[model samples]
Target: MSEIKHEVTKDPITGVETTGHVWDDTLQEFNNPLPAWWLWAFYGTIIFSIIYWIIYPSWPTGLAERGFLTGLSTIEFTSDKGEKVTTHWNTRALLAQEMQNDENELKRQKMVKEVAATPLADVVKDPTKSAFVLAYGKGIFGDYCAACHQSGGQGVIGNFPNLVDDSWLWGGDPADIETTIRKGRKGHMPAHKGTLSDEQITAAANYVLSLSGEKVDPELAAKGKEIFNTKGCSGCHTPAATGMKALGSANLTDKIWTQANVPGADSPEAKIEAVKKIIAGGIDREMPAWESRLSNDEIKVLVAYLKLLSQ
Candidate 1:
């Protein structure tokens, strides 16, 4: 192997020195020392960081008794808002104490008591109270409902109900919303595979689609309509197929076919299959109860927000 030779060069324009390193037979790395100010600044940061580590909560010693140093003590100071604040050496302890501040705690308790005492309907009717209810309810919804109904309350098709829409399986009353949030709801559609014929189930699916104003074979729909009336579909759906809110049956008149459509653009074949599958296998939608999870005041606030959605 031949030894590499150093070919140090200088630029003619600025007379800058090169580090004898070449790239693509053209560019060369400049051999320049960093500026004095930059060097000093870098060294300053190292010194400052060292001092800071000694003065603040930096080390994590395994020993529990003498693990950390308390560099700062509890000191009373005025805030930017002209309020006096007593800060503790430990951040977590300071935060815990802040949460129990006497004046703030009293105000929070008073607000909660007022909201609990007020009726849900009366709170919704009042603009001032409704504003508070909506703000508070939004946080509660984020904690509980957002997982299923989503943060915007626009639920996924076939899985959860879109709270923003006027369509509701159960009644859209404030009391109804409260009851639903507290006790939860379960909707079951019995499978027809064990009872009805395959052909009758297919016809029923097409007939159900036709009720939502979708185009279907008139002959199949006619025969399905007869079957629908006699085969117990009308028991929960009612004679007109308008759906019974008391039974939490879905309305077939509206074009809101939850299972038929999806979140994004989909093919017509997919919609048909979804409807047919529901007719054959049926579905059971259950909304878990929140009575034990949330307080009565929280439920009332959620009811107010949900009622406002349909309106």
Candidate 2:
């Protein structure tokens, strides 16, 4: 064990003594003088603070210092008959009013009508107009459809269809597109977890490919056909089990698929996976309503664009 010792060292400038104890083996420190530059810097800061307090806002009073600007310019109100001067209104409020007044001067109702009235063909064909509209539409797409549909409008397939492609699950009419955009879309495929066995789910998926000119696995098709009719697919899918437009149940017989459309996916083996998920989990796609987020004009433009896409 090291023996303890105590000593006191006075500060060189202030003359205050250290507390009669040392902390470590080699290092020895004591209350000491502040550097001349530091002491001068401290005094300079104090002087600067006093000057700032006199010339600018500070504690001890609510009044603004003489040099501080409160943004309330002295407003002169001219008399109607040149008699009395009115009170000074705040400059900020006046600036705000002026800004609002000037803003309307640029694009008032007249300008919007003038812009919208231009024939859509003229707008679409013109690069300037098309660029402006596309730029505008990109922002709208991000806010409304980007949640379920991706930022690029490439939908999360097996649930939603790709808008870039030709296949449309529902009618691709402009009016239909508009209705779908405004209202939203929901596809109903009845759940068959307990209604059909794992074997049946596998078979139904295989049977789905036969409609698309894909060869069927004989063993799977035999089992799938029995499950399809017994499970009442024909109710919504019609007698041929092709499709029923009323319920929007897809025509399993068509080559155009609204769901997954990978290359060689029409094959029974490939389709079986898709069908199994649909039968076991059931597919549900909900496209949110855009009535609240977008203006009627914006919706109209979108409707026209979607219509043009299908063609």
Candidate 3:
């Protein structure tokens, strides 16, 4: 093999140094240094990366409990229990610190305090407080209540109650709504499968449908009305077929069907079957109490928020 020649030269045309690499005999490669700004920017990025790694969490230390480098940077914030907490710089801690010190957040806290002090009725009446309750309460609802009641609060048929409608199992009063969010509610309907025959159950279902102005069999409904009054249903539902809020009984007179998906039924027979199924199988549902989980102020905001939704 022939020895390769290495040469360096300067091009006289622009007076720039050449790498002495010829492509087509005359054409040469320029030995140009990187631009000063570009070189400094590159070095600056390197320095920034080093500083970032030192100040923030970066390298894995391979330790079990303390898996990563804690870094030199620290974040300090007041915890929920009113205690000062200092920890390694993290987004979560940073957000907490911001929430504590941010001007918008401070205003929100002040508004929450005002809402807590005001009565439920007054809170809804006040424009500023009501607006705050609606906006803030939406987030709270999405976090807590949306899981069960749905994002729109329309609820699931045969499971959760539709909150947007006028129909409320318990009373619709502000105090009642507050109590519901605080204490929670349990719905119970005893099975009549053992006591009443299938015919009686069907008749009772027909009567219930008729109460809601559904075109049910008159003779069957008459028989069912008797069974409804005598079979201990009227004790909670009342003789008028109107529910008692104190007992959390559903009103039969209303077109709204909470436990039974009667509205969803395609045919009249299917509708009757829906109600019959509830009567025969019985109903047992529970809404978990938020009193322990949520603060009174939060619950108040939720009550107002729910009321606004229903309206």
- Best prediction by lDDT: 3
**Tens digits of lDDT, candidate 3, 265-292:** 9999999999999999998999899999
lDDT of 1 by residue, 1-311 (tens): 33444689997888999898776677678889899999999999999988877666666777634576545456454553557777645666565556556687656646655776887667768887777767777889999999999998988887888888878888887778778888999988888888999889878877887887777778888888888999999998998898887778888778776554522426545555677787788778998999999977778778777776657
RMSD (Cα, Å) for all candidates, in order, is 11.0, 11.9, 3.7
Better of 2 and 3 by lDDT: 3
By lDDT, the candidates rank as 3, 1, 2
How many clashing residue pairs appear in each of the predictions shown? 0, 1, 0
Candidates 2 and 3 compared: the better one by TM-score is: 3
lDDT (Cα, tens digit) per residue for candidate 2, span 1-311: 45445778775766777766665643346656699999999999999877765554354444645434333334444343545443334555456445445766434433334335565556567665555556655666677766766666667656566665545566665566667777777787768897888988888777766657667787887677777777887677776866865566787776766664534365546666766766787767677777777766677666544433433
After TM-score superposition, what is the CA distance of residue 131 in candidate 2 from its true location, in Å? 5.6
**Candidate 3 collision pairs:** none
Q: What are the runs in model 3 whose C-alpha is more than 4 Å off?
A: 4-38, 63-65, 147-152, 213-218, 235-240, 244-247, 262-271, 291-294
Q: lDDT of all the models against the reference? A: 0.77, 0.63, 0.90
Model 1: lDDT of residue 208? 85
TM-score on alpha carbons, each prediction: 0.64, 0.56, 0.79
